[model samples]
Target chain A: MQTTDISAAQQAMADESVKRLAMICWSNDLDKVWPTLILATTGAASGLEVDVFFTFWGLRVLQKNNKRFTGKNWMQKGESFVDRGGTDHLKLGKIHFAGMGTWMIRKLAKQYKVASPTELLEMALECGVRLHPCQMTMDLYGLSPEDFIDGLQPTLGAASFIDMAAKADITLFI
Target chain B: MAYPQDAAVQPPALRIDALGKKCPLPIIMLAQRIGEVPIGNVIEVLADDPATKTDVPAWCGLKSHEFVGAGELAPAPGWAFRIRRSY
Candidate 1:
């Protein structure tokens, strides 16, 4: 009789087997941030267990104190989606010329029927996309836990991220 | 060359050339092609660019395609990715 090891290996190779994905997105550029969200959400929707750890400036996206949308790094001249009623609360101090860019994006989305970042954020949460704010980066940036948007997971450290990656079938940095 | 007249009856093998394309395009193309192929068929993507090494497998992880590994091809100057459509 054949050993069951072969059967176990075969089962391991089966298509329906679950795959965990670890995605690290460290860029704070608003444009870059969305792709990570879209990709991570898409991954979760497609059945891959997904974890996204935001570090450095990337943590700004989840800051409750910084609820207003910001533009991409290079362009620096547009409104983020937050100004278009994407989120319920808007941080007052950060509001500036970038607000117009957010309006433009909303107008474009209305014209093109594209999903707004706010809509995407809702979808991401619904789809079980685990969002991790980095503890080290948060501390380095002088952001307290209260600064993060409500309902997001607490910040994680490098070792925990590595362990998550080790269990993941695939890991990505974007 | 144009697609064969009976292409619908005989599913066309997908060839995604994602060399030099950045970010989501590579992943997007891969996702699109996976849907086009029939289950159990093979799709070959030629991506010489380095990003696909990470992007392609990541896409596979999401879309349920089998990432059968990538390696240097017989002909130089690019890499080949083999994916088996499972969904």
Candidate 2:
């Protein structure tokens, strides 16, 4: 009867459910950020529905990347001037050595033909990795949508991230 | 009949040359290009990075593609893997 077609469609739906990966990027350090993008990109490429929630200092990676420093006031400017938001400006979490370690890592990544963080992020976006910026972090930093790179989902709260992660097969906080 | 692999097989419809590249890079290239070929058609992936051996097949398994096999396809300093797209 008519039930057959409906059941067939349901079977098709059940057979095609995609795996999900939920990642919370909590640090801005280049070392940590590398793994985040690597996993996100790999998961997406492997047909996983991938979501990256950028929170706290990690939200800085979503900013409009460039060499110039940013800030509107004394404290903000001081912090940004000291540590920038772009991928190249991000220092290693340990053994930063006042930028020497940063340069060496970038250099090694290039020599090895490993894509830079910016390139990997772009690739992740290309492969359909959803990028969500934490609303609380954005507001705390006084950042607006204009401050970020293109292709970011509208800012959402931690509860929303929790809802996503609840359904995710793999959840990582980095 | 089981034939010797890579024995006068038809050239793959798509060839992803990822030589001199690093880990996920080669696999990413494979993912991006695998769609260019029709289902059942093979794709040739040339990669020097050691990680390619595992990553490509792992991706193939996850995506339901078929991993044919790998061998030396020279000037690349690495092996060439033949992958058949299943869907």
Candidate 3:
């Protein structure tokens, strides 16, 4: 009975029904987030089931961002408010030079005909890639449902993401 | 390997111009438009980005489509890939 069960389990593992990609987005910097979206879009384009969980600083990418403060409390507001930027206004991880490198990178991407991070994020949505916001992070940052762009999968916790990732053919953290 | 015939044998039903698009955009365009053509028909993708060489074929294999062939653009830079809709 044990040998039979082992063979059956191996068969089930071999016969995967879904080519899924689960990615963890842990940083909000443009350079980091850009590749994450690019991979998400590419996986979707290739017909994989793609999920991206935005957590920690990465939640900034999903926020309805502007110059105004965003948190409910003083510490949250003071720390995360001015740093909040959506896909269009992300800061570079290195050589930012007070936004000059960010500007240059955007221009360079345009000149090379490479899609901007914003465009890639939109493409990820258009391709039906499932976007999941981290619930704990949302609470910590005092964000609400309306803060994100439309067409997202419901919020997921780290445990929920791990459950999904266990069944995925590929998992990435970016 | 000898290519089945030439461009005459497998004329494309549609031509997607992704001349300036980079990386995954070309593949995204191909994926979005592959359904537009009938099964067994060919779609020619014109891409200037060097990555197209591997991406087009990889996408074809990943999606179970048929990669017909590729050719240089001659006076223009880059290459064109002919893909047939297998399913």
Candidate closest to the true structure, highest DockQ: 2
TM-score of chain A of each: 0.66, 0.90, 0.87
Interface Cα root-mean-square deviation for all models? 6.5, 0.7, 0.7
Candidate 1 per-residue lDDT, tens place, B7-83, comes to: 32434378787765444445545765577878877777776656677877777775667776665555556667777
In angstroms, how far off is A75's CA in candidate 3? Answer: 2.1
Candidate 3 all-Cα RMSD? 4.5
Better of 2 and 3 by lDDT: 3
Model 1 misses residue B45 by how many Å?
28
CAPRI classification of candidate 1: incorrect
DockQ for every model, please.
0.10, 0.83, 0.82
TM-score of each: 0.49, 0.91, 0.91
The candidate maximizing lDDT is: 3
* Superposition error at A31 for model 1 (Å): 1.8
lDDT of 2 at A15: 52
Question: Candidate 2, residue A125: CA error in Å?
Answer: 0.7
Model 2 residue A10 lDDT score? 91
Please write out the lDDT profile of model 3 over residues A130-154, one tens digit for every residue: 9999999989888778777778889
